[model samples]
Target chain A: MKRSIWAGLSGAVCLSALALSGAAASAAPRVELQTDPPLSQIEPFSEPVIFSLKAVADDGQPLEDAILELLLNTPPKTPWLTTDFPVVEGTMLARLTLPAPQGEAQFQQVPPIRGSYQLQVRVSPRVPGTFEPYTDLLTFQVPENPVKYRNLAILLSILLLAGLGGGWVIGGSQPPNPGEVASRPVQLVLSGTVLVAIATLLYISITAERAGAHTEAPTGQDNYTEPLNAEPVPTNITATLEDQAIATVGQAIPLEVELTRAETGEPISAAVLDINTTSLEYERTVFDFTAQTDTQGEFVWEQQFFDGAPHLVTVHVSPAANSSIPFEPFEFSQRIDVTGVAPPLFVRLVSLGYCTGVLALGTAAGFWLRRRSTQHAL
Target chain B: MYSSKLSTLKRAKQGVLSVPVQAILFLSLGSLSLWMLFFSSYPATHNTMHQTRHHTLGVGCH
Candidate 1:
């Protein structure tokens, strides 16, 4: 028993040492990317997303001869989109396709109405056994399109009118004569309701916006030093706003704050700024975040607002912890006005509801008239 | 002569087709027309349809 125990201990130690050596030999590579659509993500079902990616080695060298495969949530074994082309200038740009439906019960030609999907980007160095394969996942969103309401409204209206008209004509007390009365209030109401519905449907179809019809490409360069806020705060370090455009909901708001010294006119780099934002529509604990400026003495915060409410933001710029001089905190406030556009689904539903309610009343009136005529005939 | 005409009309009213059947047929036709027009609710992935013969049958262009 003692001899077997000693042999087992020696084998275990040998296996562990081999495992450590194997781990040290193989190392995962590093990947850095700056892409279009602001980030690598996109809104699904909207448009074909075009993006550029940058890949480099651990020593900060560009991998010019890298094999890349773009897969959509598929296993690594299945590579539909493969390229052996070198990533020249450490950058590669490609257009991603959003498939269109071919026919009924077909493969995924179009994206789902509402859901999130992962886009997997796999990169492998061409040099054999040098670096491990690197994969990155970018997520995108697809909003649901509510299209049932319009169809329901139209079909229901047609059914009601067909039933009422058939009953009225067949169950009438007498056939029309040349000297019969011309004006009929119930029939006139029925005609008017149907006319309104037809007009509404036409208007909706003409005004509705398609998802990907007007998708503009993102500017390929990153230039953060653009013109900013109108007002400049007077302090040891001043803040200048460079962006003055309205931000839409579910869209990125580029908040640029430029910092410069008042006395020496020198740019302050790596300074931290405290951002506190509050929404006017909903009151809650203030949302706070801290960000450091880049080498250009500017910090650009890309904020996305899910709601359409106005955000009142207060930014307090302060020096770094290792600064030689300590000054008072510079505080400034700005109001961000956000606008929300109703999705096509919401508009379709409201229009359908309005038309359906009016048509129901008209159909009821026709039915009453039909019943009265039938009693008189009997 | 009026009584004979009335009898013919009554017999025609009691013909082979019934009112309930007529109503059912009307409803079925109405529903089928709507289906052909507005089948907009589609699944994200259509592996089955794509494999089958009816792969290119898309609806709701207008």
Candidate 2:
């Protein structure tokens, strides 16, 4: 009896193990679906539509030898779906296709209509009896026809060309819109502001004379040669230069000084007039000169200049009072060298050209508008 | 007594190496390898669709 019971237990355990293994062997298969040139509900007509399919085994492993079919089954009402739908040749219905090792197995084709479409994939559909087939379905839309813009593009191009031609006709050599140039509000305001600024500067300059270093003396050296007691006491003195223009660097320049005796009210005869330069390097070397003034009571000294230098020359005049009369310090200066200091010629030319082009374009616009108004009136 | 114990150990090792035990291990290991190799997540399948869209747009599919 115990042997019979043991045999029954072993038989039951064996039966259960067979059942578990059978269930695992006959498990479900897997199917995957994909689309290429992906169906777009709203996209331009320039793009293409595509589809892809893949298959896997009961163990959820990709079944390489198994076949896959990517089917585009149209809806009932769609006239594009026909029995003569093209059959892909040489491609297996469920075969696993390898894409670039890193790419998807994709197929491309055009959609027949701009409407809803469906994609179906059947994996190992032909595998007889052993494993059930797997299928997947996907849906997407195709957009309607795009609106054409060809006419608008043409009209815009014509307008741009016409404007260019009108510019050429009105931009001929004369000043841009001469009438407008005369009437331009900005030009008038700018000129008025400049005049006011100049007037203010002149007023300040004239009033500044009072604050300037001034000495009083008689007008002529002969008046200074008279007896010292006869000369009137100078209440105010003024001196004027013969010229203000000086040459460029490395050029010799002459500076003249007019001195008036402070007490005499007339120019005093100077036994000697001396001119001295300050520490500022005006020339390669420091220079000092002394000379007797002409009857006009003017003393002049000529000196050479160095480039990019500032010079101050002081004129000291000795009067009959034995005291020297000082004149305002005069400065002579030269600009830096042209090669090192000047801007490139091309840049200046480009700026000038740009200005000229703007002026020409402005005139052209004005003329075109005037013509357009005249035509409208007629 | 030592020879008897050694014979018993040899018999036990043979039982461990029996055909039935090996069959169980082979099937389990095969199923495990298949799951690792081909039982990828559904996300991977969706990713492939995403990659296809990127390719159509001439952009990064990766």
Candidate 3:
């Protein structure tokens, strides 16, 4: 009787061990990425870099139905002309699929600028929830473009020389006679306008510089700071825009971003959110800012759209520093339509006004000098 | 001889007048060029001169 009992207990223990091993074997597969010409050899503005990627299961079989999403970000501290018209050359997004026969996919991209670029890749099976998702952040460097730097230097030198020589020649000419001066009222008005214009230009320059100084690049390192021993658990987070999708140019458009847990329908409060709006018509980033969710898991802000084109708005969500949740970071993007209107009149007037003022001052000085020299000759 | 000298000076003054004209011409050309290179949104022009616009001229070009 004792021998029979020992045999039955041993069989049950063996069966439980086999079930645990099977569960471990069915876990998510790993993704392997290789770059042609290697990432280290890439040069800015040179030949494009090719990436070869594959997803393989724990049993070493390639997962042919896997999908790969790639996002490349620009370098830090890039200065933009305006929040309305942003540069789009250095950033890109691509989605690729692995063919059944090859079991591997390839992507090619050219680096436009010299700096460290952050490439985020996410791999998931074709069928949702069939297998776990994998996320990876890879960084690569591209060397500076020497030829471009040299050309820029040459151009600047020519401009500087031309400006100096022109000023010297203009100053050497005679001036307008004081006795032939215009009416005092007209003179006062003109002087006042010029002074005000000069002050406005100065103010614009200073404020613009200060604003530019505040923009910093979003680094991937800061996005993912999970403890080394901590396991990455996927969070069921969903973001939705709760306002109208259409906006008018130069009018404040309300944007309300709401975050919620997909599983429990609970609000995910205090999460860090990064938002970027890029205009498809201009192929430029129109607006980008970072905000944190409130107690209700909502972020609300208003901005004036500058163009009458479709804009892509992307939101990236990450866990807050003090949060105990160890969820992976994710992003969502949507398109918003903007109705067309005439561009702002104030910017156009200011730029043209400043240019005209300088030209007029130079011309007036030249004529004044000519009169003075002619009078001296008499 | 006095009239001849006066004519020469007058001719020289006329030549000097062209200096201002030439100067104004240079000024206009430079202004237009700078605007196109740094400020204008001419396709590929801003991207090509991106570094110079930001580092040298301190113009914002992101």
Highest DockQ against the true fold, candidate? 3
2 or 3, which is superior by TM-score?
A: 3
Best by lDDT: 3
lDDT of each: 0.44, 0.39, 0.55
TM-score attained by model 2: 0.21
Better of 1 and 3 by lDDT: 3
Model 3 local distance difference test score: 0.55
Ranking of candidates on DockQ, top first? 3, 1, 2
- Between candidates 2 and 3, the lDDT winner: 3
In Å, residue B36's CA in model 2 sits off its true spot by 65
Per-residue error for A46 in candidate 2, Å, reads 4.4
Rank ordering of all candidates by TM-score, starting from the highest: 1, 3, 2
Weakest lDDT window of 10 consecutive positions for candidate 1 chain A: A81-90
Query: What are the RMSD figures for all models against the true structure?
Result: 17.7, 50.1, 21.2
The residue-by-residue lDDT of candidate 3 on A1-378, one tens digit each, is 999999999999999999888778565465576776776677653465666767676676776666665555655533331212223224332222222223466655545456667767677766678567777676767655456456545654554443443343454543424552323432343344345446544554565566567757744542223333333334576667644446765355667889877887788786777766666655655455455676688877655454455667767778887765446787766666666543133433344344444555555564466556767887
Ranking by lDDT: 3, 1, 2
